[model samples]
Target: MNQDERMFSIDVQSVNLAEYSSKGIVLDIGGGGEGIIGQLLGDKVVAIDPRSDELEEAAEGPLKIVMDARELKFLNKTFDEATSFFTLMYIEKQYHQKVFEEVYRVLKDDGEFTVWDVTIPPYPGGTKDIFLVPLEIELRGKKITTTYGVLWTKSGQDMNYYIQLGERVGFEVVKKEKNKQIYCIGFKKKTNAN
Candidate 1:
């Protein structure tokens, strides 16, 4: 389980959350399962998830809220930093735009939104992009092969789509990292002061 956790957290580990400061608030989207980022950020993080059972399993410390990402219940410009780790794949494509809008709406001026997720490889015909990726792991000396459902957009849409969306919603792409399995993007909310 520990190895599996590390395997899934590769992208999360790439972000330097310490740069945001322990005092700053970070909203972790779909972070209730392991709350690894929350655990890393301590009291500075607020993790939200629609699954109450997962929320209950989160380690004690970070504030946990049961909510949907499509419609966040936060005031405008409320969060200094927001993060989404491998979350978009599970959501239907239609809701993605709304969720992006909500993330932009709740971030403070100059606030940053960091996202780490996988982009699907192109398939023939391009009608569908979702794929089942097989992952092998060893737990308690037994080898286990598990599969994860992944959604990949045709072409570079997986990464470009969010960049375009951020531009549309008043955010500037500050950093971009294209890793082996996942990519990371950081967008800073643009304000008149800038």
Candidate 2:
């Protein structure tokens, strides 16, 4: 297969990420590139990404930080909310659990963690080395369209994968929505009383 044939784009409907107001600081993991969450939440978001260049590419709104998701630098119960908007697909499968643990640790009691990601199927044999999801994000009466591509490998992820990981890290699934191959999940950190 040639280079062109190595890339596969899925046919998915446009996913709308509506703008919402937040009461406190939101920790946006992998909040770089377009920085969708940062753009939506403005200064209330503390966006972090592992790569400096990625953070540099993000729009000016959130407080950008260069940090790893697996080991967050914030104190326990620091953030009121956290978000991962189409970011987890970039992380390797082995680090996902650690990322969840770190997110759970840094969030305050009853804090919410929302995630938006696509369902990626396992890599089929042959030269399909890239899987791409074209997203048309609708926010605050504007539209931003982009394509996120990741290397196609053996791992396959969906809503259930995240739900189980969140549960293992003491998060309760409060909401789940699916739009075509994309999904949104809202998870609340479980406090002792609940």
Candidate 3:
């Protein structure tokens, strides 16, 4: 089949995310589109996305900025917390490490960084050119139904992958959970004992 005629639908289970709230300012990476983090945190979130249109499409609650995750414009140890809600899957795999490092640099000592993402298996040798995942996200007593589609590619993204990245970036895992293909991980920056 031709690329235009090829498509694959991924079967994903519904994920019920626990209620989360931050005490201080939160740097929400790729918090555009649905803007779930911004909706939950309100003005306490500084939501950033590389595409201006994406930020414009998000709800009017956070202080939205057009910025890249790998090149955060804030100073070192600027934010008390950071989040990536299903955002890592959208980024190129090669840039994932840089994004983690940038988040580490911008977060305060002992600050928390939470992530929610899906595990995508390596592309099977077939005619499928696109992969689509239909998700039902339950949070704060609400159910959000959406579909995320991307071009088929080799992606070995799983919970273990993020754990290693967090460890390498001087973060200790504080929370970890997985529901089917979706996973949520919380990490805290290791404080320097100087």
Candidate 4:
């Protein structure tokens, strides 16, 4: 199986989407629409993407296909584990918090939420200074912006903003860390915050 045949998606392989992912209704936000996990997990997933047909292929399988974000359908507290790998970088701040809020809403109490994404170095939290460095590169003899002074050059978000946003949504910061360009962000369902 080259790649398309074996059916391994970056969203799954990159984040260990199949193994660590338990047997339950795992939600894959923007799962490349191919949805390898739907098959790998077997009756344990609901793949949501803008193109509904992407998941339609897996209809015979145990996957539930949807054509929207977690907010569009599915009642609150509807999932066991939720994952957004490389998808959050594309998320806008306005809707970013809502996604986190929705994740909190959809996950059962004490459930775990994991996010895999690219971000700058110097973890814990980042200030503006860490983001203001101008990275330059040449393309076709023309200068192109490799990495901007902000997160937009990235998945369109600062590494710090996401961590803070998770806190705001009442999720206890179970763990947060960064390795090279990969950042592992973990948030547990809200409980006693007193």
Q: Return the top candidate by TM-score.
A: 2
Query: Over the stretch 41-139, how does candidate 2's per-residue lDDT look in tens digits?
Result: 899999999999999999999999999999999999999999999899999999999999999989989999999999998887778889999888888
Better of 1 and 3 by lDDT: 3
| TM match of model 3 to true structure | 0.92
For residues 86-148, what per-residue lDDT tens digits would candidate 3 score against the true structure? 899888889999999999999999899999888888887678868777888777877788887
lDDT of 1 by residue, 1-194 (tens): 34333222212213333343433899988878656567666788899999989788877888999999999999988998998866776676778788888998898888888886666545444334446444343233334343555544444346877788778777889999875555679888887423
| Each model's total of backbone clashes | 1, 0, 0, 1
What lDDT score belongs to each candidate, Candidate 1 first?
Answer: 0.70, 0.91, 0.88, 0.58
Global lDDT for candidate 2?
0.91
The weakest ten consecutive residues by lDDT in model 4 span 6-15
Residues 85-127 of candidate 4: C-alpha lDDT, one tens digit per residue = 5566555556787788777887877776877666544333323
Error of 1 at 83 (Å): 0.5
Error of 3 at 23 (Å): 1.6
- Residue 60, candidate 3: alpha-carbon lDDT: 95
Residue 84 Cα positional deviation in candidate 2, in Å, after optimal superposition? 0.3
TM-score of 2: 0.95
